[model samples]
Target: MLIVSGWIAVDPEAREGYLAGCRRVVEEARATPGCLDFVLSADPLEADRITVYERWASDAELAGFRGSGPEPEQTAEIRDAQVHKYRISAIEPP
Candidate 1:
C-alpha cells in the first residue's frame, strides 16, 4: 500500500476557491479504482494552509490518478505545496 500526505499553502484571499477545487478533486479521486482513501482538510491555526491525505492500493494506482495533474483552480491559488509519500509494509487493525 502507499500513503501520501501533504500541505498546500494557498493565497489567503483564494482559500475558499482552492478548497472547493480540492473537494471536487477528492471526490473524483475517491471514485477511481484502487483508491483506498482521499481527503483534504484545513489547518486550524493557519487559514491559508490545507492538508491532504491519500491512501492507495499500489504505486501504479497512485500514478494513474496523479498523472492527470493538479486541479487548475487549486493550483492557481496555491502559493506552495509539499507532498510526501510512504510505502506501507504492514497494517494492523484494532
Candidate 2:
C-alpha cells in the first residue's frame, strides 16, 4: 500500500477557487482503478492551506494514475507545498 499526504499553500482569496478547480481531478482520481481514496480539503486553521491525502493499492497503480501530475496553470498557483509518498510494508489494527 502507499500513502501520499501533505499540505499546499495558496492565496487566501484564491483558495476556494483553487479547490473548486480541483473537483474534476479529485473525482477522476476517486474513480480510477487501484485508488483506495483521494481527498483535497481546505485546512480549518489556515486560510491559505489545502490538505491533501491519497491512498493506492500499489506502486504501479499510483504511478499510472499520477500521469503528468497537476496542470501547469494549477501548479502556478501553489506558493509552497510539502508532500511525500510513503511505502507501507504492513498494516494492523490501529
Candidate 3:
C-alpha cells in the first residue's frame, strides 16, 4: 500500500475557499480506482493550516490521480506545503 501525508499552509484570506476546493478534490480522489482513503482536516492550532492523509493500493493509481501538478486553486491559495509518501511494510490493528 502507498500512504501519503501532508500539511499545507493556506493564505489566511483564502482558507475557506481552499477548504471548499479540498472537498471536491477529496470526493474525486476517493472515487478513483485503488483509492483507499482521502481525508482533509483543519488544524486546531492554526486557522490556515490544513492536514492531508491518503492511502492507495499502488503507485500507478496514485500517480494517475495526482498527475504532475497541483490544482490551479491549490497553487493560488497554498502559501506552503510539506508532503511525504511512504510504502507500508506492515499493519497491525489494536
What is the Cα-based lDDT of residue 84 in candidate 2? 97
- Report the number of the highest-TM-score candidate: 2
After superposition, the stretches of candidate 1 with alpha carbons farther than 4 Å from their true spots are none
Better of 1 and 3 by lDDT: 3
CA-lDDT, candidates in order = 0.86, 0.96, 0.88
Give per-residue CA lDDT, model 2, range 1-94, as digits (tens).
9999999999999999999999999999999999999999999999999999999999999989899999998999999999999988998999
Please give, for residues 1-94, the per-residue lDDT of candidate 1 as tens digits: 9999999898777777777767778888999999999988888889888888999999898999998688575567778889899999999997
**What's each prediction's TM-score?**
0.88, 0.96, 0.90
Q: Is candidate 2 or candidate 3 better by TM-score?
A: 2
| Model 1 per-residue lDDT at 92 | 100
Q: In model 2, where is the ten-residue run with the lowest total lDDT? A: 58-67
Clash totals in order: 0, 0, 0
Task: Tell me the lDDT of model 2 at 38.
Answer: 99
TM-score of the candidate numbered 3? 0.90
User: For model 2, what is the alpha-carbon lDDT of residue 44?
Assistant: 98
Ordered by lDDT, highest first, the candidates read 2, 3, 1
> Clashes in model 2: which pairs?
none
Q: Flag the better candidate by TM-score, 1 or 2.
A: 2
